[model samples]
Target: MVGCARVVNQTPTLPIKGESYVVLPFENYTETPYAGYRVASILEGVLASKGYNLIPRVWSINERELAVEEIEKLKESAVKNGARYIVHGSVNEFRYKTGLDGEPAVSITIFVYDAKENKVVKNVTVSGSGWVHESLGTLTQKLLNRAF
Candidate 1:
């Protein structure tokens, strides 16, 4: 696990229709970096499929791409790329015993920001025990529902 993000500048309002945006790589606060990338990809696909104008995932993302030191630069890049909103997310993957069963569960949190306002329009956190392959899809849908 790594450092967690300190959220800033939040708003209670949600985004309207037809807003363009980019799905930034979900910050990796877990032991595995690949898990973070997978989370990000899930977010991008879900948001796009739900009818949001999303930036292509493969066209603009990588591990360690958005350092804490580059907040301003990242914001500028997102704006220049025609993103009216920016999606930031994180996950904590863990395993715990539920009665007789030992299962893997993921706790995910996602933030949707209105770029010009620099405010978090939506934030969601969800956790459930299951295989990553299946849980990822459920978590992705939850994030998208909150985001849109």
Candidate 2:
């Protein structure tokens, strides 16, 4: 069996490097519990691996969607942390489909918010499916790595 993954869509320009960023937990819209947090953790690792400076913060709420108030709060937190950018978004899908192969599918949208400007600088949506033998987390990481 062969495992495969592909990026569905993404913006042409990447976020500038050498800027400090604060990564907020992604909102989970999937049936799978804590899917947002799971993806956020993976994204943090990916950013760190790429040598991006990350500002650590503790988020107690597990948001299921990105409400306007939530976004404002996230922006405020990013500004307080002195981060140039805020990273967040939502997980639209995260699960293994019901089929003979049972492929692991993941769909997520990422947003890069400019803390100083209080605006979203860039946004990208990417999705992929893994082979039957592959794991969901591994596939998710692969797809996110392509976001930048």
Candidate 3:
């Protein structure tokens, strides 16, 4: 069987093409180690391929999940870095189901903050299931592709 993904929720407004964006480290709510960083890397690649100017950050392996207050600080840092938009979210699920198929399942929520307007311009949630043969990374990339 092939993998499939669906959008759970999304705002009407899409991000403007060719805008400068800073992708903040996503919060990892799941037990999977570095799941947030994995998704963030995939998201960055996806956006970069679409021609968006992405500002890179030096990631620290010791960094912990971001707190609510840290999100505001990250947005401010994005603005200071001359990014027009800030992207961040949380990884709600990233694991394989323990059924006979051992199917891979992933769920994530993303938010796009417009620095210029000082508001959230977009919000999207996506989830998917992959066949037993599929890898979690591949399924995650596919789901994120559907998101933006």
The lowest-lDDT stretch of 10 consecutive residues in candidate 1 is 1-10
- Pairing residues by index, what is the TM-score of model 3? 0.87
> Please, what are the lDDT tens digits per residue for candidate 3 over residues 30-111?
9998888888888989888878888866344445666767766877877887889888899999999996888899999999
RMSD (CA, Å), candidate 2 to true, equals 2.4
Query: What's the TM-score of every candidate structure?
Result: 0.69, 0.86, 0.87
Tens-place lDDT per residue, model 2, 14-91, is 567788897887878899988888888889899899888888864654545456577668768777778899888899
User: Which lDDT values do the candidates have, in the order given?
Assistant: 0.62, 0.83, 0.82
Candidate 1 lDDT tens digits, 92-130: 662343554333456677788888887887876655555
Clashes of each: 0, 0, 0
TM-score head-to-head 1 vs 3, winner: 3
- Rank ordering of all candidates by lDDT, starting from the highest: 2, 3, 1
Leading candidate by TM-score: 3
Query: How good is model 2 by TM-score?
Result: 0.86
In the order shown, the candidates' Cα RMSDs to the true structure are 6.9, 2.4, 2.1
Clashes of 3: 0
**Cα deviation of 45, candidate 3, in Å:** 0.6
